[model samples]
Target: MKIFRILQIMSLIGVLIPMGCSDFLEKKSQDEVIVTTVSDFDEFLLGSGYVTYVQYANLYFLDDDIEYYESEYYDELSDVMASYGFQSWQPDMWESEEVIRTNWETYTSTYSRIMGVNAVLDGIDKARGEIEARDQVKAEALALRGYYYFMLVNTFGEPYNYNKKALGVPLKLSADIEENGMPRNTVEEVYMQIVEDLRESSALFEKYPKRRGNYRINLPTVNILLSRVYLHMERWDSVIVAANKAIQYSEGLTDYTKFSGSNFFMCSYDHSEVEWIYGVGVNIQFFGPSADLLSRYDKNDCRPGMWFDMGEYSTNRLLKKDYDWMSGSATPVNTVRISEAYLNRAEAYVQKGMTGEALADLNEVRCNRITGYTNIENVPANLLEEVRLERRLELCFDEQRWFDLRRYGMPSITHRYRYRKSDPWVIYTLREKDPLYTLPLPNEAIRNNVRLEQNASAYEPKRSGVEE
Candidate 1:
């Protein structure tokens, strides 16, 4: 089936299946399908625009935050080894036959959703409903489309701040299927479109001013995403502006002082600080926290007690808050929280040389998370470094670490991998500013779109360092 047509069945499925009739004779022709109401478009938007399922778990392996250990039963799971390229920072991670088991969904899923949102945007203006209702639906579809593009440009293209002219994922704004093999857009072009979509979304939402549920995009979520995008573009003042706007809508930070141990793990879905809940939660079976990440938390910090736990294998430490190995479901995914607004502002302040303001924002988070934490009164010499550390600690596994590492000059990282617990360790190194910083277009994507060119691979000459 064509990717653009994925959402056409959304309305039919919603209308027919619920009536308990699966007969094809009851179905209407594609030309007869009418989604002409605000409610109809709203329902269509939910089924297509929202990424509630696990899509980008492979993103975790690219960062230094995770450590991989093969279990005694590792041989039983052929799929687990598909991420070897990602863990080693190979450019072919998405394209290589060795990594075939890894399902690269970000490219396909984002475009599918964009097509869905495009359909809504194309038709919502004509839908029969109150002006306010139609506007709100338009606002939501715009926000979702902007978000999908942001994720796409960031994942497949070079960091905007690094090289705005670099090749980005293909840009598709219309629901109407264009010719096959659409070419890539520049990073700057994609970012401009993202900003434009998000700003338009914000204006429409503000005009309507109806509160959307936490599960859906609202005014706060739009501003928060804007802040993140600005942060990536190195627009420090814009970051501060957007972050402050989002902070005003937030309830406040979640104090770690209130929670302890596995008695109750703190999940972001129900937390007060959360602005949006989307994305796949971490699974310990595939990856665990690196020693470097765990070391960043001070002994006085309460997060370790709330976040990490011993995995099913005694040797592994799993992110308890992400996924409880016991009876707890592994459903927690991407959470955009108020605390990130604070961190974003803090980083922006430091960049703009507002050290005191930066420390104030930084310490606000620390005071809440640490026991008996005294505010850092004076500006520390490494205030910028301090803010980065705090961000890694607060936002670890929330899908910010890898991007942060990229924007932080794509520092060299080393990973130790073993096929099994008893096997000798093999070291994989990603050199500073490696071409792999920008991920490859999925092999299938290139095969389908002949206009697409793959990014340069980091694995030049394919060197796998000496084993330990």
Candidate 2:
């Protein structure tokens, strides 16, 4: 079948099903035939229906890493200035339909991809094909599903550390769609499902063909993801084990010293160091690094110069060259690379009181990014704090900082913005453990499915009469 026809079928699959079940499986359209052949399922998995990049634009807005110039020119652009609510730590940034739509898209798009994966899992066993081809398709789908769920839970559900018993996104296992409403699963249950899928994916990958592309998920990628999931679950020992396994199979970090100051490289997925790359493309025109974040980079650290540029107004805009801007290309706003594995291991080591091991791993990453770097012979008493700082500096704008802030005891974040050079600055503060830390579900989603429950914190009425 043609790709459009397949997508149409997928759309119908998404819409026809009722809200009762948390699984991605929806009732099939009467007009469409059930896809049973491995070839058709393989084509569908690789087709446009499968969302390759996950978009977390809302999460990016919530981080302390960005700054918007307060100016008459920017203020005239309502849509552009609207983002200020996110940066200013407003409680209900989802007031506008556009903002709500963007947030809602993230939820639906991710689940759509999950639905595609479920279709493959449901049909692969019945399809007649070469055993290797079938196994490869199944393994890839399983890994992709696991990854999507990980993203969903992290974004929509409460932080695992906050309350495992807290409500999580609905858990959908099978592809069979039904008309029953499903209650939210506990955070623990959702995590257990993610772990199960990823573990199965890891075992399946060993039997499948070697996956070479950074875009594709294989054993190493699966392990790296597992490391992240375990880190969130506070399974420190398991995190160390998973990170070490992933590092053993993946590429080492790129040495910044090799590139001249003027020729500093951008962090792109094509870079040899990236283990897995998946995220929506970011438009650098509207975004820039906060002065405070930029100040953290050491004079010798090459990343500051490489990832940012001073614009005409002297503002430090994120470098556009870091992403693929060509239409249809997957511009990764977030990624999983080999360096993260090292950092994951280092954090886990610090939690286990293995300061020396932690420092070794931390220095390993610093050695590559900082010029003329030297390793310390002893670990500091504040080794965990040191590791956290390194992680923030290293992964500044890649959507990790905000999540880190939440998981790290929800530290208070204060942002300062000025409308113009001569204007007094407006200050906004995000308190630790504030309810706004958790985003509310989109209004449309709740309306469409009455059974859906809103986050307690997200229930605040939208603010009105706020200055643009």
Candidate 3:
């Protein structure tokens, strides 16, 4: 990518640059004025990564709603996601101008934000902080860079283990130096890069004592993410180890069962769990199940509803700013919870042929909720079906539904079930393919990278069915 163009875009976004911060705001301090060194630059740059990381959640809607709901194809696909498990963008189901624009903007912005992060990592070393802080900062920055990459990789890149050699976007770790039209890297290569970054991050943070907030990625959060990555990799042994480490290092959830009152949703600290390594939450939630999906359940279900998944440590007043405006977890402090640890353990058991063990892990989660479930145990006869239900209900909008469905062999963006037009009242079963699997790399990115092969399915015409 051209440095000039990239810089221009970054400036427009008010990213990585302090020039846009003032109406000539007072005067600069002595230290601030002279410190144009890389360390200062690094500090400036590092903030951009956090910005990108925050936007990752915005992409949740595309996968769950749009593709999962279609004509007859809708009913079939509900087996994967959505409340009605349909009503999103199924080929041509949802055509509102507002929803369409929001959908478009949310998904695309994730890529744009990453460009800002790359800028900081590429040029922030002239004046590294004191020896200790300098190293710590780099570790956090590097790991976060990988964290953003992993999000993009999973969302747009095909499953790495399922198809090791599948093509994914080129690694753009450095904003200043990526080539225009960079070619796709093998999915394995993309994963290798992510693994390396996470491993480096884990080692550095383990040694650093002061890693409680956004400043440094903490031990528990790292293990949490590591467990997730391993599960995605289908590395059951690694998944088990990471899950155990997370549990041992941190406290578990806030015991939702014991929390008082009907308004339990607002408690940020419920179900005592470990502190998140890099937590960023806001009460100003921008997305929820569109009206069509919510029409299926009671108006108050806080669960992801086939859409998706929250945060804490509030110095920014963020936790309170939009607290009264949204649904799902109350307080802006959303979390990556203890439930994830159980989910991972259950998945690991599945791979080990210990179905009983998997069921136990799952039961542990189901039995704990104040909102109780049936004593259902002994594992489902259809193994994939069991995983799908557990993962869908557990992970919800946590951004795991699409991947879980994909990994389990029914990979498609379009809903699998079909719907009948005459019977808005009737739910007929049908399956169709209008897959929204991996994201289509932005037109701008693809145009810039000559070597990059566009996702072959990127331009599939919208039709009346969901993809398989």
Q: Backbone clashes in each candidate structure, one number apiece?
A: 0, 5, 46
Each candidate: RMSD to true structure?
4.0, 5.3, 8.4
Q: Candidate 1: which stretches are off by over 4 Å? A: 1-27, 30-32, 70-73, 96-102, 208-214, 263-270, 284-286, 311-332, 458-460
lDDT of 3 by residue, 1-468 (tens): 112234454553334446565322122442122323445544544444554233544344444432222322322222222223123433322223433333333223554556655555554444444656666665666666666667777766777666768886677666554434457777788888877877776777677663454434566666777888887788898888888876776665444345433345422433355354232443222223333433433333334221222222221122311243345432234456667887887878888888887887776666554255555655777764565466655554455655665566544433233233333332222223334455555554455556778665566554343243
Give lDDT: candidate 3, residue 379: 70
Q: How would you encode candidate 1's per-residue C-alpha lDDT over 409-452 as one tens digit per residue?
A: 99999888765656778889888998887877776677767888
lDDT of each: 0.74, 0.68, 0.52
Give me the overall lDDT of model 2. 0.68
- Model 2 ranges off by over 4 Å: 1-9, 12-30, 33-39, 48-54, 70-73, 100-104, 261-270, 313-316, 320-334, 417-425, 461-468
Would you give me the overall lDDT of model 1?
0.74
Model 2, span 1-468: residue lDDT tens: 211223343564353423243222222554444455567667667653344443566666677887774322444344345565666655556566655444434666666677768767777777768887788778778878887787777666788999888887878665555355456788789999989888888777777545756355667778888888899999999998888778777767778777765655353655657666555545544467777888887889887776666546633265523523435555544456787888888999999988889999999999998999999788888889888888888877665777787788887777665444455666777778877777676555566456778887676554333232
